[model samples]
Target chain A: MNERVGTTVLSLTGISKVYGEGPTRVDALRPTAFEARAGEVVAIVGPSGSGKSTLLTIIGLINPPTAGSLLINGEPVITDGVAVANLTTMRRRELGYVFQRSNLIPFLNAEENVRLALEIDGVPAHQSRTRARELLESLGLGKRLAALPGKLSGGEQQRVAIARAMIHQPSVVLADEPTAALDSGRGRQVMELFRDSAHAHGAAVLVVTHDHRTLDLVDRVLEMEDGVLSEKQPA
Target chain B: MMDLAVRDIRNDLSRFLLTAAGLGMLMSVVLAMTGIYNGMVVDATVLPDTYGGDLWVVQKGTQGPFAESSRVPALLADRIRAVPGVERTRSYMTLNVQHELGDGETLRFMLAGLSWPDDLGNSLPLAQGRALRQPHYELVADRALGLPVGTSLRLGRDDYTIVGITSGMVSSSGDPLVFASVSDALRIQNDLASEALRLERESRVSRVRRSEYGRDPANLARAGSAAPLPVTSPPPVTAILVDVAAGGDVEAVKASLLGWPDISVYTIDEQRELLVRGVIDRARRQIGLFRALLVLISAIVMGLIVYTMTLDKMLSLSLLKLLGAKQRVILRLILEESLLLGISAYLVALLIGELAFDLFPRRVLVQDLDRLALLGVILGLSVAAGMVGLRKALAANPNEVLAS
Candidate 1:
């Protein structure tokens, strides 16, 4: 990939997520520590009910971990149990998320959907529109700029969603089964896009997936089963 | 925020427009009700306005000619004219009678009797023909009576020709009015059946003949006996309408009339107050109650629509939260959509209300003040409706998107 792993951009230490208390208590994730450096693509693979999605959510700053600390660029943003005051700000400015179904706003077309992410960061409308077009074009969505989510194919919709996520140039891009809704060929294209995005933008990219056919596109792969994580050798 | 709302509405334009039009029709009815109330007030004051009299003189301790049976001597018109500052006086008599159209249809009309020439402004202005120039058997009918100017109608023993047609001359109860000469009114008021008159005369003559004077001619001659006795006594006129000279003191004239023995006087203001507070009070209350109920219903409907729309977009709202759109942004979007719907509906209601005026059976009076007040009410209602959706939006959880 001709990319050197830079400083750590996302770090999770002793993180755990518990559903309830007493007898009915369940452990969604069991005390996990993970780090991903800039210019690196990391994948967590597991079957249903594994803790892959849980750990990804914790690093994405969506749900606070039960007992853990989160550090961004080596700065503590969550300690013990409390999230910092700037968690939302950090989430908006530093973290990008791509979900399983693309989850694009149905009313907005591709260009507008991508532009919204930049506009949320207070970017000017003209600049945001320009940057949105550029990002979509780089993802090979230039001709479908005005196509609504409903009009786009499944693969095209996912590529538009990827453009939306990367338009803001966030420090970390977190994805959860983004290729689950696509075929193997489209899934490979999406995974390769993520690898290229991570290397080209010098951002940390983490993905949770069950598909093993596209494992070679990621720099490192981690396996999770029964709420536990183990480093795995790539096939 | 507006862009989002616009796009959303455009995507479902038909549904949104239908909902707004439904609300608009309801609002139109509400506005029409207000106009109806105003029309009632207008109807009640039409007489006082057309009278052009500074003061009204009627029987002692009576409200006025409209509220009660007021009887005053016809001669009192001259007496009122004698007072200083009195420019003119007219003996005014009013009564309700049914005119048979002869095809099994009868229409009730209020008959107004005043002096000919009507110099004191006691007659309604003509819209078609000349006013009553001849004294008797000539009438001026209001256009609402639907009588042509050349038509003739019978009241009692006489047929009167409709000489003039006036518009908007009606009683407090919305009955059409007909103006006739004072003499015709007196005869109509005092007219009795021939058989009844004959029987009454016979009874009187028999009583006189049976007395001692019947047997003694010498005493009868000394008593200045008459061969016949009068059969009927004329009924008293209704009231005396007095017009003061221009720039004259109405209170002074009213005070002078108040000193008389069996008469009451009312200035124009008192007459108006009596009509409004006395005759229109019940109607106003009923309309007010209806307006309150309608406003409440509109508010509830608005809230329901807004709440439904918010629930429909629950997933989108949750995703926006996950995408880091703040609570305020979501709230603003919902509120903007609500306002857009409300304003559109309000405009539609106004347009429909204006068209409905001509269709109402009674008069519908639309005033600018009423329109402005309704606008304020609608805006307030829109904000209140928006609050319902805002509550739902505020409770949106970002974590829900992750679970989905």
Candidate 2:
């Protein structure tokens, strides 16, 4: 699996996540197998508490599965049994996260929020600012760069979050309900941004959203139930 | 790498400012206490240093002129001058009394007796005009009292004229020193009233006897009526100021005065030390208490701030952790916030200390080094406080968020 310009960008085989111990243990995500390749938007759909987030978390490398292989870009990072610690540095440099609520830091302006990942990546100030400006402009947030999180509308905040996630040009972008806070029109715009960004960047974009109306933007739709995921839209 | 403390402070300016203000007030209080003590010590030794004496002889077992009552016989200077290595000795009658001015203002003045014309013994090195030259009439007063030259007032019984004023001649404990001739001061000290006025205040029977009897009543006759009234000699002179002879062995001379019954001897340096320590003791203790309390308050406030901040950011911290933010990154953020709070409060404290010192009644006398020292102290305290917050932040479990 090569997350960047590869056939399989992400692979999860025999992945399981359990909570608690002994009698109280819950297998949130049962042993599962899935793959998302380059230039694809994998929509992971499920009812609340139906293990959708668990599977997404496992795939996103935010939560490691109890038993499985999590291969990224053809390399086995989490193989058969255990997660390697050095994956954190890799994830930060190569992966981006977007939450449902836009979870933007309140103090920073939209541009600074977008530039944060670059700064964390040790990019020089002038170059990071230039890239941040360019990215925000491309995302139609040029005028809103200096506006704080509170000043922006819900749709704009999500757009800023999207920009922040994609600004680092990560090979994999994981958005959990990225359009949940916006109206239908704004939701449609957000879905379009992800689709366009994924197509242009040639990176695998995985989004777990309940809004089926904008499912057209995704290249693949996966429905999850009781830790099991099935392809709703065939390849 | 990101200057987390500054960035966080910038994010919530109002919170930072409010914390700074609170710490500033505490710093001001600490500064005020320090100033009061410094002023007191300065006031206590001003007289001893300005008087510039090599030796002081006062009554024995007394802390000397300032701490307790001290006296020597008025004529004791004659004997003291005869002692080997005695340079020059001056006798003075000093008594603490309040003077009521014509303007209804009362001031505590030390009646300093002197013999003038020669201006040998009782003289203030004139900072402004000449010393008091007239023996019986003119007076010299401390310049700290704000009295102009030639200002005169009636003290006790005599109507004295102020001919000159001197600077830096005030006595220990802030009493204005009044320079008058020895004869005049003795009159006020020993012989102000006539025989008639003395009898007038006695018992009616005792008061009438001197008038009924012969004008010069015999001692036996006087003693018969008054139960052998022990002659209470003039309240012995306050203290005798002594100057060592040119190339005088001051140590040897001081050793001789120790044998004199009911008298203590002190060099100028020793007197100044006693005076300074005496005046500053109480103020020192009070200031020390204030310093301790301010430090405790600073520590507590910083700790509370760190704790509160950690609690507020717990969810975000957990989210970051879940996103594979290493514990070191989390640790850095927690440490940064803690330090940010401490440094902000320290700056606030410094400003407050400056303002408080400026407005306080006494001279605060804060130097640059004190500021630097205080800054160091604040930094140490801040880091200590932040540790409390950092501990809790470190303990926060990313697994907690997933539970619910």
Candidate 3:
């Protein structure tokens, strides 16, 4: 195990979300407490409307929790339900996300799509290009760097998305069903990439998925039910 | 950073260029409207500019010869010459006439008369041939009339040869000007049909018999003669153009002419202003309103186009925002694309105008300043259109990328 595997990089305490008011009020999350340490690939699995995505959104910093203290890299991001750190800056510098689909800009080539993340962080063009090429090559996409998203296969596109997510070496990488569109064999490959990203780069990888075939590749599995979250033991 | 706007355009170059071409055609029409108004002003003032006179003396209380009718005594030129600062004077006459072209076509023109032996239209810009050399049968025709030099035109009872051709010499109303001697113009104006003359003679005979000399056969015979009676006084002229001597004050000469209660005097600049403001003011306003409306339409259409384009990129933009792309970065992308579209459309408009403006029936004077001003307007329009797209882009929900 990597030495950084024991360090807690993301922490969420008593985080909950509710919609509307009065009789229309409904709980989306039930005071969830979770920690994702560096060099750990954690999976959150649940059926539809089970609050898994709600928890993911909160961890991704895309939605503010109704009540919570959230921290990243030992710094307070959201304290007692009030955001103390700039959310946009933290999202840019410390957080990365991969969606179900590749979500690459269609007009840009594969390398350019990956380079866009670094470019958004104000990286120099030449340096970003070099890093983007290296990342894509490491993801087995060196031959397809000049291909647009439309020309790349589903598995190849997902790999490019993974490269894009890891380009800035973010502390926490949130993925929402990163392998849902791939076949079982290709799905396992992508899950393995998440494992590699966590172990080699010391990133706290959290994937929200329904795919079970790749669950064995993850370090831990957390299951959600009825807006409640709990750890599930291996069979 | 990579130019996101340019990359998008290159990815869909054919569609982008087609859109620009459509916008270019609309912009060309807007430019043409401006040019037509400019052409109208130039046409209204061309005569005054070419006449190069210091003052114009017309009938009192009237804006003569171009904007309104003002007929003064033809000999008024002589009286105007007596002013202290008046260096020279020429009798100016104008009449609108229509002649059959022998092909079911009627040629309508403005007949402008120049004083022969004194003013043979030497001041006119002759594009071909020479000015009127004879007092009775020579003419100077504007090129717009489509009459070549040496073409003889029959007016009234005489045939006049086109001796000179002037280009761009049209009246305030856009009618081509045909120049002739004062004598020939007056004869054409006064020429009467034979039957009308016969009736007038008989009426004169009856009036003479009814008078105290009713029984006098000599007076009856004189009235009944077959020969046409001679006019007792000369025909009236439209106005008198005056030139002031060097180191002379034109206002003083104009004031002296204004002293005559029967005539109105105006400086050369005032004459041009009368033609522009009095003669073509309504037309200018109409064209101006049309130009303004076209600019507004261009803005609206461009805005809608930009909005639609932004909608097309909604997903991609959402993904970028979700990836922590700055708001300003996305704004720059939209603004740059809008500017690029506007600039490309403007270039296309200029090309269309250059190739096609002359084909218009009326003169289209596309001035450089007008082009520069329009470019500024297009830039403004581009920015405005970009704002429409930027609003949509900024409101894009980055969470939608996750949903998708």
**Which candidate achieves the best lDDT against the true structure?**
3
Which scores higher on lDDT, 1 or 3?
Answer: 3
Clashing residue pairs, backbone N/CA/C < 3 A, model 3:
none
> Could you list the CA RMSD of all candidates, in the order they appear?
3.3, 5.0, 2.5
For candidate 3, give fnat to 2 decimals.
0.60
What DockQ results do all the predictions give, each relative to the true complex?
0.49, 0.34, 0.70
Question: How many clashes (backbone N, Cα, C below 3 Å) per candidate?
Answer: 0, 7, 0
Tens-digit lDDT string for candidate 3 (A1-235): 4567769999989999988889999899999898999999999999999998988888888888999899999999999888999888888888888889989899999999999899988999999999999989989999999999999999999999988888888889999998999999999999999889777777899999999999999999999998899998987
Worst 10 residues of 1 chain B by lDDT: B219-228
| Model 2 lDDT, residue A232, Cα | 90
Candidate 1 Cα RMSD after full superposition onto the native fold (Å): 3.3
lDDT of 2 by residue, A83-175 (tens): 764666666666777888877766678887777777766777788899889988998888998898989999989988888878877778888
Return the top candidate by TM-score: 3
Q: List the residue pairs that clash in candidate 1.
A: none
The superposed Cα distance between candidate 3 and the true structure at residue B384, in angstroms, equals 2.2
**Consecutive 10-residue window with the lowest summed lDDT within model 3 chain A:** A1-10
User: What order do candidates take by DockQ, descending?
Assistant: 3, 1, 2
| Tens-digit lDDT string for candidate 1 (B191-293) | 7898887776666667766787667776444334434565344467877888899999989999999999899999878888898988888999999899989
Query: In model 3, which regions exceed 4 Å deviation?
Result: A1-6, B200-229
Q: What is the lDDT of residue A7 in candidate 3?
A: 91
